[model samples]
Target: MQWTKLLCNYRELQLVGTLNGGQSFRWTYNKDTDEWIGVFSKTAWKLRQKDDYLEYQVLGSLLPEFSGNNTQIKNGNAKTCEESIFKSLLEKYFRLDVNLGSYYKEWSAKDELFKSACQQFYGIRMLNQEPVENLFSFICSQNNHISRISSMVEKLCTHYGEEICHHEGITYYAFPEVEKLSEAKVADCICLMSLNHLKALPVDTHVYQIAAQNYLPHLRGKKNVTEKMYAEIGDHFRLLYGDLAGWAHTVLFCADLKKFQSTDHKKEADEGVKAKKKRRQ
Candidate 1:
């Protein structure tokens, strides 16, 4: 595929921050080429941002399974492995449409700590990851670190997921879907530790410490933070930060880790208010 380039402010979205920003587990940085590498849509790809533009290049052909959603190219005279496909996938996956710089500016006005954190990671934005994959990754994150979570997620895919491609002797497997995961034995899935669920932030040491000390005092320095407390603190954050609470959580919660903890309480509350007005009417 021809090299594809898209212009983006490096100060708004970056490869290093997003890939390692406590979300995705499959991406790797190739320092020699200054590129971030990962497999998506059953294809291996390399992405790098230079100056003010983000560049994309796919290493190998996508497997047949990635065809159904991409029939537009499949039927066209152009190559099945077009740069446009990668561009579209990358844009959607990274959520390039949302302006992180604007968000950071909005958050900086709200809190001093958030201001500092945002400056440190000015370009960092919460990746809008697929819910199911995000859930399983966070599940593996319990009592584990990023490197370990990544390994566990990889193992889950390799053991249960369908093989997508083989290049440079490395076999890449798509992250398994619900049906694929369900087909596995309970014992095996447990052993893999890849079972999935999430509502609040992907809580880690930083978020835990912050919650214990500043956010939720119920724990009050207690070593144990319950799942209930996690949700409560997350809800409290939503109340404080409103619509962008998830993105705000991402900025304040982590130095080594980043997560967006928020809920749709605002939307729900608005709906309730509208319902009460309708009754009065």
Candidate 2:
């Protein structure tokens, strides 16, 4: 069993509308223990630890079976062989590498408020997400809150993914293929929390919300926004920041911290109204 913490960095996972939209899963490497952990299935999965090496069970049987037993694996201690399938997948499915500093500089230079938001919130960029998976995952995100989004993603992985085991207690599931979802009874898998809602939902909530708020005036449509519009917004960010689409969404959500402020304001407003009524009496 090779023991190296294989970091799975996918930006699509962090897209604004992704069911798995968060960046904590992208973490610093542990060189000493060679173990890494990521949040999937609404829980964290730590990589298996072994002497002389660390191994991340590539979630599905995306790779061929290794030839050795535990004894041979231990004695050999050779670096785990590269899985070309995974390499091709890493390339084909995700947009991995990015220059975050450049993107930040450019975006901040364009807007002072954006610069202040980054300084206040310590914004980070997104990387390595597959577009098709992003589309489906975001479809699962419509009108739903984060907790439910996480559960929905877990269900999709557990139900459709090919599973693989690592340590005695741990296992991982890969994201299912597009054809699997496209052919699926979309309603059976997703619910309104109904799956019918899923068919009509777009992939990026930031795009949807922003367009709804008319933040981007160039886009115009009837009553409901279109998936193409949301994708176009994501594409615009991708063009401006390369792979910072996920990062941009995070920053936007963070800037909207005023939603909390609005809640506080409502409480104060109610209290003031009550005080005025008491004095009037």
Candidate 3:
């Protein structure tokens, strides 16, 4: 496998936050190599980042190549065709066309809390995931945490999704298609998050707590989120953050997660150490 350079900045795309910050659960971080391994669009990918760009390695067998009209192309340049298709898929998956910095500035200007969150959490962008995979994975997300959700998603893929490849003694599977997930459950807000409906806010316990304390104070003492309250919470965020409310909601959600707290603290500490070293010099 050859590593292809993907034009991206860490500020525009933080692999850790984007992949593990609760949007999709398939990606696993290899701490030793500082690489992310995951499957998307029926292909397994290995990704790592540098200062101003990303490096990707396509793993396993390449899927059948098809043109815009879904016709298989038989040509001598099949390898080139696969690379072209994969590159385009990567761009679309990350929604690389959207100017995240501009949106961050715009969102920060509108909301004070979100502005603070932007300072701590940058480069957390919404992924444009496949609808069938997104729908089924998020269905597993309901009433679950990231670890368990990931396990469930893995099981689904292992049982139903096509086998992609084996690497480092572990096997990767493509996310099962819609037909394979006929009996699977469903969830709404996260499905919207994956589908890039920026205004759709999926309210869960954490979001409800945040809303009760900051946005909707009336529900402070409530035990659970009722159906009516769910819509109201979604409406509140949409009204506050405009069309990309869901994107803004993600920043806030990530900020509130305990999982990211230690990572942020360690990063800040590392930066502090680097600054001190500069001062000593």
Candidate 4:
């Protein structure tokens, strides 16, 4: 398999946090390979980061065709054309056009709590996911944890989506299209999380907790988040974080996650032990 390099720094993109941290449920980390394996844009991908660049490998024969101009393929540049299309898909998926560092700086400047959170959780950017898939995934997310949500998503793909390929004993499938999903439902939060509407904040339990503890003490001790309270929370976040409130909300949400806390602290401790051992040697 040939690997292509994508120009991206750690400050701009962190693959582990961005892919696994409750954004999308498709990706799985291969600990042995230190790479992420996932299906996106009707193709399977193997992605890894090295210093300031991302290396990607298309895992199967299910490649997305060049939709813009067929002249390139007809002119005997099919490989190059396909590569370009795949790169474009990745760029869009990761929202590479957005300057994450600038947003981090802007967010940090506005909120001191956000500034502190940014120190530990940097490069956590919003993913531009497929709307249909995002809708189904987050719908599954309701009153569910990541593990169960992932399982449900896998089942959805396996049963409904078109089978792309089998690699390493795992069958990959494309996310089912709208026409294929007859019983599908919609969620408003899907727009903010997946549809590039960054200002639209989706107030859930996590957001409610963060808001009540810090922004709105009135929300504290409330048994449930009412419709009025939801609106108030969304308005407050928009007022605090401006147009990219959803993006900022995601960062805070990730920071407050127990999984992130345990994993991040463990990783840091492991790194610290390694450094100490190296120094002793």
**lDDT of candidates 1 onward, in order:** 0.62, 0.44, 0.79, 0.81
Candidate 3: stretches off by over 4 Å: 66-78, 183-187, 263-265, 268-281
TM-scores, in order shown? Answer: 0.73, 0.49, 0.87, 0.88
Q: Write model 4 residue lDDT over 120-166, tens digit each, in one string.
A: 67888889988888988988998999999999999989998987766
Highest-TM-score candidate: 4
TM-score attained by model 2: 0.49
Quantify how close model 4 is to the true structure by its C-alpha RMSD in Å: 4.5
- How are the candidates ranked when ordered by TM-score, highest leading? 4, 3, 1, 2
Model 1, position 180: C-alpha lDDT score:
65
* Per-candidate count of clashing residue pairs (backbone under 3 Å): 0, 15, 0, 0
Predicted structure 4: lDDT = 0.81
Report the C-alpha lDDT of model 1 over 89-204, residue by residue, as the tens digit.
Answer: 77776677878777677767866777766654556655655555655766676778778898999999898777655656788777777766533232212221222211234444
Task: Evaluate model 1: give its TM-score.
Answer: 0.73
**Better by TM-score, candidate 4 or 2:** 4
The positional error of residue 7 in candidate 1, measured at the CA in angstroms, is 1.7
| Candidate with the larger lDDT of 2 and 3 | 3
Q: List the residue pairs that clash in candidate 1.
A: none
Model 1 poorest 10 in a row by lDDT: 188-197
lDDT of 2 by residue, 121-156 (tens): 332433334444445655665676656666687678
